[model samples]
Target: MAIMDLSSLNNLNLDAGSIFLLAITICAFLIPVVVILPPVGLQKGDALLQTHTKAGVEGARSNLKNQFSAEEHAPADGKPPRVHSLVVYPVKSCRGIELARSRVLPSGLQFDRLFMFAQLKSPFPVAVDSTDAEKSQHKWEFVTQRQFSRLANVTVDLWLPDEMKLRKQSMRSDEAFLILRFPWKEDGWRGLFATIAAKLGRGRAAEPEIEVLLPVDFPSAAEIKEKGYTFENVKIWKETINALNMENELPDELRRYLGVSNKLALFRVDPEQLREVYRCAPSEEEAGYQPVTGFQDAYPLHLMNLSSVQKFSSEVPKDDDLKELDVLRFRPNIILSGAPAYDEETWKQIRLKPGSSSLYNDVSFHVSCRTVRCKMPNVDQESGLRHPREPDKSLRAQRAVDEGAPLMGCLGMQLTPLFDPSLGEDRAAWIAVGMTIDVEERGNHVYIKQ
Candidate 1:
């Protein structure tokens, strides 16, 4: 080794250039050391101080807190909670259409869960393709996202034709159709290339979305004989009722996309044959009025608090894939904001009052029961793909609130509208997006249905 470093140093002046060079060398040497080292108080093998700690998850356990802590129940701003948005699911298990204003009827928000999918008791070719007389003998059961997650991707839109145009075309005044769209795969090598391109985010293009028009106004059971539809008894939950089978109306392409081209078919609820809500919180017998819904699982209206969803997301592990969960995962008919997290669990009765009192009277709803959640929320509403585990896993860990079903996680609330017999069939009350939700009563909820 040659000793040349000292000789160069003797000729060099301590100028700005030298100072800058020294600073750079010092920074280069220290940066790696500072970055690689652990925090001052932390040591190797010792658990790191997590930004979102397990304390959040532990604190989220409803069992750990009071039934409804008074301090935590009310909104921080002390303002009444207002409707954030309204959603109408024209078809059960399919996507919902958000609405700014919706009419509230004795049944439900108009046209909500008015249609549903059902599969023949036997597989498609055997029962579905059989002759009309033979087809009526086979049983059909309702299907939902709980069984097929891809149903989430089936987009539904209500399309009402212009009145004048309809009159010119010689169509019925009540004629309306539901426009449905879903993703589809093309045939042959083109499909392979398209899939590759989509994955690579390149020039890959997908086939045009498969669109189908579903008749919104179906003939009643009495009129089905003349309309080429079969009025059949279909099973939804445990109740078997008459539903108008619209299998002949739907296109084969849309059915194939659902992998039920032959086996599954569409059905519309028969208003005359609708079942009454059995598992009500106040009990329909005690409430003195029986309310009915077409295809709703339990109650007429399902509500969720946005704050509760946010609070649930906060309980998710920091390293989890989902940073925050979407509110649509729960499939709420009405979303409420301006309230604290998990506040709806304590609400027993509430009134939805619009900004303009003159437009419509305040509509009251008996907060029926806690919405005992299933793994349905695990499906992404946008992608139509199911997460192996996520919000559901976290839900089970933190939000098993309803003791009625300790194993099942609970979020949101089921509601039964206090329908006025005086309004009759023609007059319907309206609820808007900005309506305030007044908590008329608060009490502990008993999960009535599984």
Candidate 2:
């Protein structure tokens, strides 16, 4: 029995050794393939895709403090008023309207960027085949900068089908078309119209052109009444102000008016301060932080001031012909009128009442990050026009791109609560005022007094 057991053990050992050798040989052959092959065909992460950090926020604030201390202390005599303007972009790249009252929501302003036009086909460089048809077929997806930059130019007029009859006009063919104009360059018009035509097919040619319309009719009281429209048109009226005219560009009165642009709806925060409280940069974390609650984008919030717009206008090329300083280029929810130039860097907190609510329910929002300007800022919001030439002739004008440190506007404050009951229960949550702000600047890391 002992000898039989030993023989079985030897046979088992031989079999185990052969199996182990085979496994090693297979692994040796497969290891190099695993190392060389890309994972799921994804490219290497981009270096430009940086992770914003508290350290970066501290550096930004330090530079801002040193450069603008005097301007910050300069008497408030000529400073803009403390009014606020609350603007909402119902459709993503189309025009946004100033709200008399709005609700605060977690994602952003209620009904903000809720509707968008998806191109059924590429509006540019027409595609030759339907093999990649998915690229061209656009659904009415949510609005974002990714779809259109001049989305603020696309205005809409809501109607009950019957009211729309008046604006509908018949052209050459028995077919009537909607007379729609975008505020930005008409570059995409041909493509957009063609796409629309294709979508309608030959069957609807006799019918009036049904364009995607925003609820806003016109900006002026007279225009709104004359048009017999029911949607908000405050932005249209404000743009008609002489201050926004092409020649005058930025107006002095607008500086004063900026404060009341949306006093109850907007807030500004110091990014460094925000990082200290969350223990992480804004984009790196989820949306529970005060800043994320108000400003839905990756950055803290959208910010713009009359002073900064004016500053950009002053640097327009001397030899070039430029249009008015279009504020709509930067789609900011809250437009600040009174803050000092570049003062957003140091701002800590702001207080505002929610729209449609009694004054008793006023809310507070905290400032989180500094808004960085982009090339889109150069587009003319009124005409839907863009610079015709190259980098030298572009609308960026004199704006300089600062890598580590950039100038920003204290547009408005972000809040903790995502929704405000005043706007509506179904509306998205909003960031409000009265929230505390944490600053993370180099030596002065601390919370700002509300």
Considering every candidate listed, which one attains the maximal TM-score?
A: 1
lDDT of 2 at 419: 32
Q: Model 2 lDDT vs. the true structure?
A: 0.37
Q: Candidate 2 on 30-96: residue-level lDDT in tens?
A: 8687556522222111111121101111223322223223343232664333324456664445556
- Report the lDDT of model 2 for residue 300: 30
For candidate 1, lDDT tens digit of each residue in 164-220? 655556654555567677776688886665455443332234433555666677565
Model 1 is weakest, by summed lDDT over 10 consecutive residues, at: 48-57
Error of model 2, residue 237, in angstroms: 32
Worst window of 10 by summed lDDT in candidate 2:
237-246
lDDT of each: 0.73, 0.37
Report per-prediction Cα RMSD to one decimal.
Answer: 17.2, 28.7
Error of 2 at 70 (Å): 19
Model 1, position 213: C-alpha lDDT score = 61
